[model samples]
Target: MITEDSEFLKGVKEDDNSSFKAIYEKYSRDLFVYAYNIIKEKTVCEDIIQEVFISLWAKRKTTTITSLKPYLFQAVKFQIFNHFRNNKFSREDLTRLNIIDVSMNVSQKLEYSELDQIIRDHVAKLPKRCRHIFVLSRYHHKSNKEIADELEISVQAVKNQISKALAFLRNNLQLEEVAFISLILLQ
Candidate 1:
């Protein structure tokens, strides 16, 4: 069955100009806002979205876009990330990029990745319920109530399991300088 949702993708893949225009009109504003929020520059955000659209149009015949919205947003995200990475950041600029650490030195990013891997290993060792709750909270970014509902547990139980998991990680891991840089970035 050809889903109504994918009509646009199919039209685009078949080199239909109206489909490309409709897709742009639908997603461009939201994409621009997302890029602007991350980059805090109007011109750069505009250019990024333009580049994303142009790239999408170019790749339409060759690439499969099952979900148009994510493909658009992900392209903008990569462009924004590239902008941050290619350009030098002042300490002030670094502070504004939010929790994303584009300013991290190569070695610091490496340390951060190593620390993250170690933490994931320890998370895997947790009891099943605790690990599930913690993964929902951290990796999946779910609220306590949401996790509770999904797991059929009390909100307090969700909180307790997340807390227990965090406490376990704290005891097991030695987060030092590299992690401190991450903390500073978050602040």
Candidate 2:
């Protein structure tokens, strides 16, 4: 027997409007909840969900989504990350966004919050120059060249300072925490 997901995919591939509407009705609320946990803004979350569905419809003829739920969730995650990155959110905002998992239990959320605080505290402990370079690169989304030019330093100096800052942070945080922080910084 063909699975429900396959049935949906077939309908979507055939450009059926009702199928598209069905997909949206099924996934939009969960996607919105997932996004809101990170973005904490109703309007922006709604817009992101709308964009995802719009893109889905636009790509339906060409795209093949084997698993709709994961695909939708991943799209929402990327959109939320882009929103955070484009808006130049602060480290605190990044921290809040990074550690949130809507599927997590209460204890997990508390653990994530503690880890977030640890990362923030360690970042605060970096030397002034290192912290400046790190913040310029990560929080402000500045290129190494831009940061160097603004600081009146060589690009290599900026790179070195960022490296040093990351090294310092790595020394204090666990491997998983470091990875999580790196994901936020790099993205």
Candidate 3:
């Protein structure tokens, strides 16, 4: 029998069903474990693993993975990071900086992701460099030096970019405007 990794490589290269099944059966548990380590939320970890596999299968023909295990685990890690990074709480923390009260209601729960997406859409419109600096500082909580190193710029440049971006956002958004946007985006 072809080794499981070999099967996956073949499927990824050839779109073969048997190889795909072998790949799924062999790696699902490992993928789940990897995702759990990064995500810590059981439900979210499971979701990440599922999405990883679905994406793997969908993109199999175009993928050129030399090592199935590491590639899958890294994919899981990236997915987990993206989910938490995109979660509503991060956006709320950014614009509101206030503690939120959660109630036990389906509608309330369902509104969060919608709001996050809305805010993300607006943030995406920001200039590319400004957006990168802002997210690194706000979401990733990186220091100026860290952001500078990551972006391969001077620390002063990092600080200047953040200041300019914040000033622009503040000018464009008044208190009421920010509050309204926050409520609508984070509803």
Candidate 4:
């Protein structure tokens, strides 16, 4: 199916200015609102959003985006984080704007969301039984005993299924140990 996001991306790749404008009109307000919430500065938020759009346009020819919404949101978040990291703001200044903790939270959220998408995509490619067992264990927070009982399988079978799933994901994702551990902890 040719989704709206795919159409927009196609237009962008073809250098359609109107398509870019449509994207800006559709997402700018939400992005601004999100940025303003974190930065608490209208001018700074506006600048960040503008820069995000400019960067998106500049990279349109090279970037392959399956989903534009999350990509844009993540870009805004990275820009915000960069603003905090690059500027020599004092603790008091950061605290005064209530930005320090919020920025950290946004950073974690971006990581988690990206990892979650990767995990979901890999899970979808798993074998049917392995996918079911993995989803039950990770998404439903079910124990091996519970999943085995529900599926009329042995706990050893459940363990094997989960192991297979993890092996596939680990091989495909090639995630760092810390990142993979954090993902498991989050689930």
By lDDT rank, best first, the candidates go 2, 4, 1, 3
Q: What's the TM-score of each model vs. the native?
A: 0.55, 0.55, 0.44, 0.51
**What's the CA error at residue 10 for candidate 4, in Å?**
0.3
**Sort by TM-score, best first: what order?**
1, 2, 4, 3
lDDT of 3 at 3: 68
lDDT of 3: 0.64
Model 4: per-residue Cα lDDT over 1-187, one tens digit each: 8887788889999999988998999889978976786678899999999999999999999999887877787687678767877878775444333222224477776765666676677789999989998988765546689899999999999999888887787678753422432223221
TM-score of 2: 0.55
The digit string of per-residue lDDT tens for model 2 on 15-79 reads: 88888888888778877876786677999999999999999988988888876876787678778
Flag regions of model 3 displaced more than 4 Å. 1-4, 88-187
Task: State, as a TM-score between 0 and 1, how close model 1 is to the true structure.
Answer: 0.55
**Better model by TM-score: candidate 1 vs candidate 3:** 1
- In model 4, the Cα lDDT at residue 79 comes to 82
Evaluate residue 63 in candidate 1 and report its C-alpha lDDT on the 0 to 100 scale: 89
Which pairs clash (backbone N, Cα, C closer than 3 Å) in model 1?
A: none
Question: Which of the two, 3 or 4, has more TM-score?
Answer: 4
lDDT tens readout by residue for model 3, 42-160: 89878888898889888877877776766775576467546644675554444543222233267755665554455566667779998888777655445688899998999999988
Residue lDDT tens for model 1, 1-187: 8765489888888899998898888888988877786677999999999999899888888888776665676677668767876798765554444334445789978866776677678889999989988877766545689899998989999989888886787677664522332221111
List runs of model 4 lying over 4 Å from the truth. Answer: 90-187
